[model samples]
Target: MKLIVRHAPLFALFVACGDPPSDTGKVVAPDSPSVIVDTPKLAANWPGYYSDTLPCLDCPGLDTQLWIRSDSTFIRLQKRIGLDSIPEGIIGRWHVVNGLMTVGYTGDKPEFYRYTADGLLTVDEMGVADNSKQDWTIEKFADEIGDAIPRMRLIGTFTYWADSQSFQPCGAEFSWPCTGGMDLGEEEGEPIVRFNNADLQKAYKQAVKRSGDPWTVEAICTLGMGPAAEGDGADEYIFIEQLPRTIERCP
Candidate 1:
């Protein structure tokens, strides 16, 4: 099978979650016996890239990559190994509160972080951490994020099914040697192409000629970073691919 995969640059792997206002509002001073001189400078050292392989319930582990910028903006990329699915990204605004950092997004849950001597560490909602915990630790890297995230490789056979009303493209998760019905509509942008009648007819005829059988299609796309934070819009797909194939049934 011919492979058509793309590995977006480290910066490209970033996805903007949603814009949440910066949490830089002034903190009301507490009335206490002791006086305070100045607020801490946590945000100064907070700009950089961090990554880790955390525990996963089903797959090998969750590969997480995060980028924190000086302007209080951040982006994150998450990938699930053993599952041939697309990598997901999030972009948002971030701020530090009493040494704890909060990354806010639109609909999903927020992520928290804390500063460390070596780098930034992922923490729970309460801003606490156990020194012995290393699973969620991400070390600071050079400005460029090259070679931080590992590329995902996928090889499989895809089948095309169509009718007067709809077109369905299905793909398998693992190699062709495995047996099971294919999963449909798992692609990130499959729905975007369904309305094109000309393309649909072309693909449908080719699949039918191949006896509606599966054909090996190798595709690779990157889930890279979108526009900078506070930019105008978000991309519907962080990753995309154009499969190069001469349709033929698998033997």
Candidate 2:
């Protein structure tokens, strides 16, 4: 008993100071892993404004009109052409890093775009086309839009992550991935898109009216932007994923 007492304190001290002898290994608590989403750290550029700087004039499908206020804080958008049933006014939070912007909405996960000083803006959620939330009074444009809007063909769609594109015509199609840091095309003249067929127009019109398949429009637009080709309008790109319609040439 004396021997046991003499060593008990030493054993206790060893257990206290030495490596833990539990075979359970590191007890990683089974607590839920926290999700780390990037929240925008507001910058000094309070009340800054960012819209489509490289305006997509007439890309097939989708309709777009996004205006993000600087501080990457608030945004507002509407249909630049045609009308929609989905409510406009997608009020949300935003983050801007360098020229990139991440917009976090109240009802949905966050998205990305670009903020610029030169009035040139770009956004993610692009596949081929896409929407905005605001006070859209389609009833007002009812006279001119007509039932055609419900089934407009030329207005097919796509949802693309639009960036400043230095588009190069690969084999047959124009591949718009270049290293020019969001080139707003030629910022000299107006940009425009001329529909070459009826199906294209109809598919697009349907999207503008329905905001669904066959023309899930994810359109883009800009202000002082132009096309690589000669034109009298603004530059445009079809954000495809967000849209269902396509300009797939008929067989």
Candidate 3:
């Protein structure tokens, strides 16, 4: 004998395929409008040299000179006022988010700052303004910070993509296309091809094998302005001078 089976209504199938009902028992559409967030824009006079003398416990004062470049990079020089030591230079990337600027160092905690009328004011990590009257402001000294590009140590992700190499600084949002050659003065006939050094390549390959492609690396490089990767304007590019080693992560 053949058994008869009952089937649900055709509308039930349609209900199963449609969007699930809301908590209020109403069908909610999946194609909802999204809220757009606007990115923070840097001030007109954001890029330049800023200087200030900060108080120090052991020394009379610390003469600090900060260079904020348009390429999302910064160079900070600090010298003890009465000490015989040379100025210490720190190189890293700077980024502004939610109206606060962050200076990210290679292996240190980020410093925060806020834009002021004349310069930048040091702030806490939570973006809170310094309450004491110790004068934590760095006054802008010059509008043009010179055209010379200095060789500095950088920690970033080195990637070879699309048949081209690039370096993304530890805290930067974008990557700069990289070139291999570096000037070796009058002694060398041609520039040293540092990027293709066997040790550097081996480290990069090992990094890729361990943590996938585009691994983090520490290197000494020079930053220069050049044509954008795919645009009509100019952008910052990196010229590798030395590849020190591969870093497990960005600090």
Residue 32 shift from truth in candidate 1, angstroms:
29
- Across 166-251, the per-residue lDDT of candidate 1 in tens digits comes to 11112211211111111225468555323233453455356555545555543233333333334686422222233435434221
RMSD for each of the candidates: 23.2, 21.6, 20.5
TM-score of each: 0.41, 0.24, 0.54
Q: By the TM-score metric, which is better: model 2 or model 3?
A: 3
Where does candidate 2 stray beyond 4 Å?
Answer: 1-46, 50-72, 85-87, 97-99, 106-109, 123-251
Best by lDDT: 3
Give all candidates' CA lDDT scores: 0.50, 0.32, 0.70
Report, for all candidates in order, the number of backbone clashes. Answer: 13, 64, 0
Looking at model 2, residue 64 earns an lDDT score of 40
* TM-score winner, 1 or 3: 3
Candidate 3 wrong stretches, greater than 4 Å: 1-44, 52-65, 69-110, 114-118, 125-135, 144-148, 188-203, 210-212, 226-234
Answer with 1 or 3, whichever has the higher lDDT.
3
Candidate 2: what lDDT? 0.32
Q: Report the lDDT of model 1 for residue 32.
A: 40
Please give, for residues 200-232, the per-residue lDDT of candidate 2 as tens digits. Answer: 344444544432322233222212233444456
The better-scoring model by lDDT among 2 and 3 is 3
